[model samples]
Target: MTQPQGALLVGSIAFDDAERTMRTAATELGGLLRRIPDGEVGPRFHWIMFQPDVLGQAEGIERVGEERIPLRMLDARPLRVADGVDPREIRFPELGYARAARESYALFRRLREEGVIAPGMRFQVSLPTPLAVVGAFFPPEQRAAIEPAYREAMSREVEEILAAVPHEDLAVQWDLAVEFQIIEELPGGVAAWWDGAWAGVVERAAWGVDLVPHDVEVGLHLCYGDVAEKHFVEPRDAGNLVRFANAIADAARRVPAWVHLPVPIERDDDAFFSPLADLRLPEETELYLGLVHREDGAEGAQRRIAAAQRVVPRFGVATECGIGRAPAGTTEGILRTHAEVAAPW
Candidate 1:
């Protein structure tokens, strides 16, 4: 079997701080990782769940539901454009991504200088695609109206990150979780306001890829919703993932530096991996399968790896999503699983 090479952290480590996240990942995974993230700490520990609070800071927007959504909790209440307010006139405050990244990058730099983090590893900043934030927070009718403003705000966040972090040492990952929920038309998932689901998704993914200058490394983290450490919808196979990836490759200005896809814990069968045979990514674009589950540890990851090798001979490994929400005390073992399952790059 073709052995898995390297490892990718799909953002968010369970650590409480960036320092611990970086130091621990560097210590455990070491040479297996090409880049490391700031553990999506603070309000971002729950992925984009904190975005509603950020968006609510806008002058013309207000939370519409009766139940107050607590910070960092996954509540379904949506934000709405206030009466007599023009959605287009809404101006967002800092969306928090750039601010968090800037803060984390400082620690990353210090750690690297101290030789805690390796010299060559890039500091990774993962931002959700604007569509993710807009789609999740706004009603379908409000999405088209509010999306333009949010997209612009998100673009500016990307620009700020670019300016603050040096290109050579930076890597940006656009997280695309909600897009899959929309694509699969799963119940309770956000519906796309645009006409064609596939077109809308690819268009937004390409737009995000273009925002990062070619000099810096950028990648995509394609995902299904990761609520309570379970996929909103389990993929029957890798067909949709491969198709979406190929579409982004064809549509984007440049191929992504890497692309990650999730693997459910129950799937260690060849049928689940068979669709990877049709993946058309360029040789330069790396592929990482989120095959390492804390439940089964390295042993389960090895099973999934064996299945994947039958179709694609080369790839890397990751958890199905970020480890930030994994059950407590499992983070260290999960990191070690990646090291155990994959050869260091």
Candidate 2:
């Protein structure tokens, strides 16, 4: 196994989402948060953005239909909208995701070229899945209809990104939160949706790999949610973990990708590491462990990393989830501390 000289984060970046919230205040807060977490650190850092708006722009597409997509939590009958309504008339916000990718790449290149990072450093870019992108922007009714087109567009955007960034120096993380849910509800009905809709992302992302010049790190990250403790995180058992891990392993076979999971923050170490202790990883893939807790400080981060090292070797470190919703000062401190610990020996 190849040990990372420094950290490659799969968590939140400092940038605020323009479509979701006003950037000015959030950016300020995010900046402040980064400073403390950073600990004026080691092991160069690459702040990753989970920006779907960037993905949307890269594709050159839009959702042009009117429909209220039913949420898993909502009443299906009442939420359903009339069919045949032209979606073009609805004022869906235009998210310039492609432009964002272009700019993001430019900024990274500038940082690398301008002596901001020492030679032999790496930067990682992470984009959320199509389901996440659509769920955040379009109404529930429009999600299924809008997702297919958006995914096709996402592939194009990723290609353009590969053209600009140094493949070996870059890593792409595909965030899939659906895997956890697919298990518990599989024997029920959610598996049908997973089969029909959720599965396409794995293939599309793998296809995105072909667009690259080769040697670029492409990873798949599966999580429960952004921040909220909803249906997915509620007291999972060993059986649930086994199912999720099995499904993920299946996906890994088809795609040349790394798999990531949060450490056992909520569960005991025995419960968390026992099953995975002997699991075989793909020859070229990595098993990224999300080692830092969201609310943990420097001490907490240190303790978590030590505990993680005790159980899992040759693992990548990451946050419990995206820190987009977290204040800047806190996230920065966490990130910086992580980079320092992950620095080469």
Worst 10 residues of 2 by lDDT: 35-44
lDDT of 1: 0.90
The top-ranked prediction according to TM-score is 1
The lDDT leader among the candidates is 1
TM-score of each: 0.97, 0.64
Please provide, for model 1 over 1-345, each residue's C-alpha lDDT reduced to its tens digit, 9 standing for 90 to 100: 667999999999888999999999999998999999999999889988888777887899888878886654545467999989988788999999999988999999999999999888999999999898888878788889988999999989999999999999999999999999888998888888989999999999999998899999999999987878889899888999999999999999987999999989999898899999999999999999999998889888898899888889999999889989888888999999998889998
Give model 1 RMSD, 1 decimal. Answer: 1.3
Candidate 1 ranges with C-alpha deviation above 4 Å? 71-77
What TM value does model 2 have? 0.64
Residue 310 in candidate 1, Cα distance off native in Å: 0.3
Clashes of 1: 0
Report the C-alpha lDDT of model 2 over 74-136, residue by residue, as the tens digit: 211211112554433232232333445455555545554765443444445566555555554
Model 2 whole-model lDDT (C-alpha atoms):
0.47
